[model samples]
Target: MQIILGRLDTHLGRPRQAQQRLRAAYDGGQPPAEYWAAVGARLGIAVDDPLAERLTAADIAGWLHPDPAALDLLDELRSAPVQLALLSNAPAVFGRAAERQDWTRGFQHLLFSGDVQLIKPDPRIYRLLLDRIGARAAECLFFDDRPDNVRAAQECGMRAELWRGAPAARSGLRERGAITP
Candidate 1:
């Protein structure tokens, strides 16, 4: 998921245009990888192109630069007495990349939409994650970059926050008692 954002930033190099393409794909019910490919094609780029291949590969980490804010949050929370789970609307490639990163062990359970065919903002996926984690909705605190996803999580009875950056996220988590100030 973060890799997709990075690809949009670095490869496409047009934030607004990339966001529009992503939104259009979401509206059309396409998965992230398909959406990326479609966007590339629309830009006259081919799937065989190195950038496209890297974005679509199972080792997308090679093409990704980790977001420092997300890393900070993970690092801070990993030592807390709380469970961490990752619920991502990502493809198998993203999962493969995550497994290669030993630091991702911070997450006790990882769920990807491609693996389950259940995307975010979908009520079922939220239920699935909660169930797998043995957590009640009220006991979960979810953070997402998308408003729709945050709303959906709230609808499912979990505490949801729109993550803007490290500071805001840290403050929110602290307020929720998920971490110390």
Candidate 2:
């Protein structure tokens, strides 16, 4: 993701401000065209540039590929009868890409910040997730690599954990009786 973004930065004259603008707009639910338009406006590039389109496509493509081992772990949890859901701070393109993946079927619900226009660390997004899954906050176990996001989930009354890696996650789940050893 950074590679593509870095390319975009180079294409847009490497303005330091572009990084924050791109990240904010992308996480705030801007679609490809709109997102590129915003970046172009900020960086003084032509919004209709072909390079922007190419970069957007590349960024979405980057997001489409998931780690194979992570998918395997998801499968293991599914077989364990653990109800799984995905709550990610990603753009609408990511949500579209995830829908096309066979592994996504393992999730009972897939919520993207772009689809809902709500990003993580926002209490409202967590509430929306709880509403979508028909569960109380305390009933859910949330995991996120970002400390801030994990903290937000805890504030929402979830039993949240800072995700270290697959091994740690699996071990934690086993310890919590979410999956059998």
Candidate 3:
């Protein structure tokens, strides 16, 4: 079984710009969460209170256009025996994005840390993931682009890979015996 990632699967190339704005707000002593909400609003990302607390690297991506290719891949993925899940720190905005895609069927669970008030690299988040996915860490293979988060998952006994794509994901799964080659 795999806890598949979406936004953290690849760099969307939004950080420098988001950080510039965030730095200004942070220096001005505005709460980072508040500034993030403001920035998200500018990008047409809608947020609610619970989602405000669970921001992640993807939260800064205002330029997120749906990847038709990615969508096609997800559609195919849902047909597989592998269990698929969406684990992101994105708040309500993720739901909005999902609504836009009409692709809720791709994932068995939408584990939004924003709603849960937890973020990855935090062990609690991993526990939450473990519980939501109904598996011990050993039963799950985690994929993400962040090394630190990958490390965190590893420390928790979950097989994890820093995703490069299907090849890497498949390789990691097979290497760890989470899936057959």
Candidate 4:
């Protein structure tokens, strides 16, 4: 069964530049490599520098990390009567980084926008998660840091919350009755 869970980045650290550049590129329907190359240029790095060639493949540590408070909350939620999932708008590199973290196996599924080429606020991706998990729309509760993504999930018939922080996330889950108040 699909269980209610919050977003990954809201509780984790990420490479600011890479994350921003990637999301913007994907949203703009442009390739991430091109975005990074341009970003490098802005930083005085030549577009043809080898750094530009491997920018996207940089180690996850070079980009994001797990937030301690968020991880603590996640640990608490792990015992709740709900399955967990990581819904992130990141490239495949982020997924690889997650694999090295202690919380990697905590989630039942890891959904990345790059994997499916469909970002949040796009109903099709939400439907894809539901279909892959064999859960009905109403059976899932999703949390996202972005209001648009949360609203999209609501439109897809799932209860959703805009995850602000640990306390906020806890309160949201409690309100949904996913956890005790």
Candidate 5:
């Protein structure tokens, strides 16, 4: 089994919302993306959307906390013939955040949307992961907090798990034969 994941789910580093909160600290509290984009005058990712707001790596330095069960999950994942790949919507800074975490290990590869310049729900991103690993969609499974992303993976023929957080994910994985300890 292959595991394709989101950054927040795989590490004890800056979580998605916590990263947003850290970003908001610098912004005027209007919503970090818009607030910081304006304050820093950081250009939008797209030239057509110059007014588009964005979040930066500097905004999230040490705000992330790992879920207690995360390591347990990783430990179990490593016991099997699993290929773990990270699929997140983050920049190099996000990877750095995980690097700062002592427990972030064992993942085979990382493919970030920011690095790819394309976010999830985009089939192309899934294709990129599959192509890199030489993994077939039929044999891969994706996990994410958003149903939309899950749906997208399903459409691409990869099994998708909509993360609602802990215990359930652990239980589901156990049933899938992806985890055992």
Candidate 6:
């Protein structure tokens, strides 16, 4: 990702601003084309530049992948007496790609920051998640790898926990009586 950003920065003749704008544009719910177009407008380049297309393709391709262990855990939870949802601070391009993955099927709801223009650590995003899932904040168990995101969930009245990994998540779920022994 850094490499792609660096390349984009070089292409735009901006040290870091191009990358920042691209990220902000995506995080703000702009589509890939729109994102590139915005960057092109700033740099006075044609939006159809092959370089932008390549960069966009590379960015989407490198976005994310499903963790096998996490998928296994999700499989275990499928039959448990709990609802599953995914709240991710990712671009809309990645969100669209993720929806096509089999692993994402287990989730009842998938909320991406780019899709909603609401990133983590923002209390409104948590509220939006609760609303979308049709649950109160206290009824949800939120897990995030970032401390600030977890803290935000906690502030929103959710039982938020820092995600250590699949093993720790399983243990935490068991401890919370959210899963079987």
Q: Which candidate number maximizes TM-score?
A: 2
User: Which residue pairs show backbone clashes in model 6?
Assistant: none
Clashes of each: 0, 0, 1, 5, 1, 0
Q: What digit string (tens of lDDT, one per residue) describes model 3 on residues 1-181?
A: 0111233222235556664545344333455467556755555565555555555334434525545655665666666677877776555444456545566567887776555666777789899878888889987777877898899999999888887776655555556554543
lDDT by residue (70-144, candidate 1, tens digit) is 888899999999999988876655666776786678899988776776788889989999999999999989989
Which lDDT value does model 4 have at 94? Answer: 65
Off by over 4 Å in 4: 1-22, 26-32, 41-45, 57-59
Scored against the true structure, residue 91 in model 5 reaches a CA lDDT of: 48
Query: Candidate 4: minimum summed lDDT over ten consecutive residues — where?
Result: 1-10
**Which prediction has the highest lDDT against the true structure?**
6
What range of 10 consecutive residues in model 5 has the weakest lDDT sum? Answer: 1-10
- Candidate 1 local Cα displacement, residue 100, angstroms: 1.3
Tens-digit per-residue lDDT, 91-172, candidate 5: 4456567756665566787775555656677899899999988999989888898898899999999999998666777788
lDDT scores of the candidates, listed in order: 0.75, 0.81, 0.62, 0.69, 0.63, 0.82
**Residue-level lDDT for 9 in candidate 6:** 58
- What 10-residue stretch in candidate 2 is worst by lDDT? 1-10
Expressed as tens digits, the lDDT of each residue in 41-133 for candidate 6 is: 665665665666676777767765667788889998998999999999888878888898888898999999998888888899889989999
The list of candidate 5 runs beyond 4 A from truth reads: 1-35, 39-58
Give me the runs in candidate 1 sitting further than 4 Å from their true place. 1-55
Write the candidate numbers in order of decreasing TM-score: 2, 6, 4, 1, 5, 3
Worst 10 residues of 6 by lDDT: 1-10
Please report how far candidate 6 places residue 129 from its true position, in Å.
1.0
- Which of 3 and 6 is ahead in lDDT? 6
Whole-structure CA lDDT of model 2 = 0.81
